[model samples]
Target: MIQGDSVTETHQGILKLRVSSLIALLFVAAAASAGCSEKMGSAFAPSAVEGVVGGGQLQFHDADTTSTATQGIASGGKKARWDALPESEKAARKARMAQRKARWDALPESEKAARKARMAQRKSRWDALSESEKATKRAARKQRKARWDALSESEKAAKRAERKTRVRIAK
Candidate 1:
């Protein structure tokens, strides 16, 4: 009975080891791909500039980018779906990314550092906007609403009537 139990235990341990190795390989693949994405974008990289920006530089204002990174405006912005590409296309995408990276590298170090710092500060300020500031804005909004609500009934009626007339004329 002891020998039978020992044999089963060894078999299960080997099976566990194989599963762990497979999982480890998957993780390694994921990590390698993540690194590639920063440097090369995906196999379907639509914009070369984005791939370059995804790394350390943070490109936003370049003429060809999908959007102003700060304003969150993009020309082709299908933010949900990223991957799904053919291999030949992936090679082409990688070439495009290299070009973008080369252009970015040509800038003077001082300029590069300055731009990086400026963008960092901008991000910091955007992030650091306080709850107190938010509350103040809220209070201001409420004050405006309250003032609007305080209008005399006759004034409100006149505005509503004017709006209705304008709508009718526009239509």
Candidate 2:
């Protein structure tokens, strides 16, 4: 089961444990029933667990070193990865993954997709305008700004008063 390099400080930060040590420890404990799940991921032999850490009880934990076999490529996609696997298992796993991805994609987005409806509405306004109509509208907008700027001082004060009365600022 120990398929890679020995555990070191950097690897420890990454959650790798020695499976060979675990297997050795299990053997020393006479736990023949303690079968190593070729997949359960360990580097220490079962017997090695009792080697001398603290000179007492054995230490065991979930190992995290990913094996070379977990390359994410579906080897023989239609075939079972494990001989014991049922025929339907592969299809079912694929179906589940597809569903998971769909759900993830469907999830509301914080920065993008969630506001799609709002964005589409805004885009629709832009999309509906003809090129010449848009140019005319831009000219009209500029004229409106210029007209507002040309207002007399009294006209500006009146407009500001009207705006103040119409707009209720929330606390």
Candidate 3:
């Protein structure tokens, strides 16, 4: 009877040990999965150290150092760069605009008339707006312009590159 009691005690101890080990293993697995989730989330997050240029070049900026990426870039702004382009490039751009205009010209007369009517309706709606409403809209536009002006040239280039890529992908 004493040996049977001892055997039962030993069995209970082994069962307890197994349960504790299983609980520890489960905790470790949960922590590992949480770590993996964090890594996966960060993989999709935007990187703060790198930017995309207009030419799709990766420009790295160190937080501890000043960025020299825009040093050699033209600094007269977008219009100035357009003005600096060669006549051939200007002509090509003009040709692209002309092509767009040609497409509009080729549209059916009814479609054009409908578009004109829509534009007139839009103008009428704007005209119907109260002075205070117009002022609010103008203020919003100014705020947007100021915010845009506050961005660095590299940031602007990155935004343009991203927009172009998105447009290309959408098309």
Show the lowest summed lDDT stretch of 10 residues, model 3.
42-51
TM-score of 1: 0.28
lDDT of 1 by residue, 1-171 (tens): 246435576777878767755654564455455553423643322222222212211222233444322112322343322345666777898899999899888998788998899889877875588857756877899998898799999988998889888844421
Q: Name the better of 2 and 3 by TM-score.
A: 3
Tens-digit lDDT string for candidate 3 (1-171): 347435576777878767755654564455455553323532222222122222222222233332222322532245577898999999999999999999999998899999899889888988799868987998999999999899999999999899887844320
- Cand. 2 TM to true fold: 0.26
Quick one: best TM-score, which candidate? 3
**TM-score on alpha carbons, each prediction:** 0.28, 0.26, 0.35
How accurate locally, in lDDT, is each candidate? Answer: 0.57, 0.57, 0.61
Candidate with the greatest lDDT versus the true structure: 3
For model 2 the local lDDT of residue 151 reads 100
Query: With candidate 2 superimposed using the best TM-score fit, by how many Å does residue 140's alpha carbon deviate from the native?
Result: 1.1
lDDT of 2 by residue, 40-140 (tens): 44443232233432244433333542221112223232234455577698678779999988977777566356457667887899769986887798899
Tell me how far the alpha carbon of residue 54 in candidate 3 is from the true structure, in angstroms, after superposition.
46
